[model samples]
Target: MPSADRGVFSLIIINKAGGLIYQREFQAGLRKLSTNDYLVLAGTFHGVHAITRSITPRIPNSQPPPSPATSSPGTAPAVSGYSYPNPGVAVTGIDYLETDKFRLTCFQTLTGTKFLLFTDPMTGNVDTIVQKIYELYADFVMKNPFYQTEMPVRCEAFDRHLGAWLRGRT
Candidate 1:
């Protein structure tokens, strides 16, 4: 079992089609889940993320319109913008979900790949960690010629680099 101070518990990567691409447990803080259970969890989270994105309340455009030079022809922006917290940015589903035991931090790439990081509730700098994980994925997994798109990640380098990076964090 992992010590109480271990910050990260696990990481789950989901493809654009809601398939589980990669999953790793950094610390044995949580009970072990079966392979099927992990797949189901990935699918369920993907559905919930879609629902959350769809249901997010769009605030009306209260700010002034872009100037003539910036404004495109016949392309006025939506009256009700989808982005929350930022107007121009597109809506990515729930960024962080916190519970008494742990916090789930999600980071979605522009290509729709999602990184789900499970960390201790008290863990800080989760965003930075997620970003670094994404960078590692891009470098080790995506860059590998043998890697197929939207498939399970089997790259040894990705696994090695990710484990090393997480270990350095604690």
Candidate 2:
């Protein structure tokens, strides 16, 4: 990707518990919604993400493990290279939701904070944009002394730097 696209629509940040920490629109187009509506949207989307992850198919183990009796007396027998993957905390939610008009790209951090970037559907280099946004989030938001975990992000430095960086990229 040579550069970040100029068609950025908006961004929304959600805490681990699915609370909206930040929300902003970069360009016009998306319909404006009431405050309660935005909160409901965040919560509903969080539920959908969880439901999708829960339905992931699991492959069954072909052969059962040997009986403990067949193994050494002190050690218990265990299956090799076979274990069920945890659905919860195992898979990241939907990476993106695309429509003809725009695309919603989601980037989730290790701490369970999620950054949702909305952009034009044809935009390329979106992953790069999201990554940079996340970096800015870490540096300006997470590292700030005043910032509180799982609380709304109200850092002026973060807002200023994020806008500047994204503006420069575009």
lDDT against the true structure, each candidate? 0.88, 0.81
C-alpha TM-scores of all predictions: 0.84, 0.82
Clashing pairs in 1: none
Q: Which 10 successive residues of model 1 have the least lDDT summed?
A: 76-85
lDDT of 2 by residue, 1-170 (tens): 33354468888898989998998887755689887877887888788777876776565567877776788876755766454466345666688999987899988888888888998888889999999889888899889998899999899988898888777766
Query: For residues 85-169, could you state the per-residue lDDT of candidate 1 as single tens digits?
Result: 6767787778899999889999999889999999988887999999999999999999999999999999999999999988887
Say which candidate scores most in TM-score. 1
Scored by lDDT, the top model is 1
lDDT of 1: 0.88
